[model samples]
Target: MVYALTTRITLSTYESFFRIVRQILPLNYNQLTIITDYERGLMNAVRIVFPQTKLQGCWFHFCQSVIRYCKRSMNSLFQLFQTSVEAATVLRMVLALPHLPAESQINCNFTMLDGFQIIVDYVNQQPVIRERLQAFLFGYIQDFWFRQITAENISVFGLEFLKNDINRLLLYKL
Candidate 1:
């Protein structure tokens, strides 16, 4: 349910979104699905304030992001493989994500975990995106995205246990 709406869009503004939502609902959303556009500021704020919620990227926005990411993450591939048609193919895959049942989503999450090595390689090769995002998306992919699906292998990913503790504390007031 929509709780509040305001024009101010900042980290603090997003915190208020969570605050108003919780005050209205009074529910423990240890498991919840949050579909959002490519608002990284709000996304990070949500991650900080609601550690348990599973954040999913909107398919439309994700398609836009593919274009954005392609522009930002260009290499030899962009002239050929990064055309709009190719991006549509990728968008189609992302569009399929929401249709999958919960069990399939979990499996896809695990599959994403396996593909993270590709992300690591990409980051290593393309430092510009890392610097541009200020490590936000990179850190999100490394630390939060699909980690719960691979909780058993978290140690291999070498998460910041201290940061997780801090997230739990931040979650309490939200």
Candidate 2:
């Protein structure tokens, strides 16, 4: 629940947000939840401070990252899914899987599901991309949307979706 001071949103400005959140909410709070726009600086700072927090960037922000890293055609398909309930439903199911072969992970920009082996393979295969994706998933994916309602119309991504998204991107099947 933070915004930039000016028009341009930089990491420094974003980091200030955690300070603001801390000032308002006590550090003794163990069950803290953070929702942010996935600005790298803010994300990094949050990690340093709240290592175990349930951090979730909005679905919009998650989609942006997917579009940024995925291929043009894959992005287009995702866009279509975004607009259609049926597609998104199929996508939601397909994206909920948490395991894939090593080669498939690379084609989809190094995203993978949550498992010690899957994460390790992904990281070993592509260190830089794996780091970014892992940061995004952290606590965010681990406890995703236990209370989610279909009317909410936003997908809470976790390692499960990461695995599924990669498969779809690689096969162009879903």
Q: Which stretches of candidate 2 lie over 4 Å from their true place?
A: 1-5, 67-174
Clashing pairs in model 1? none
Backbone clashes per model, in order? 0, 0
Listed in order, each prediction's TM-score against the native is 0.44, 0.38
Q: What TM-score does candidate 1 get on C-alpha atoms? A: 0.44
Residue 50, model 2, lDDT: 75
In order, the Cα lDDT scores of the candidates are 0.47, 0.45
**Candidate with the greatest TM-score versus the true structure:** 1
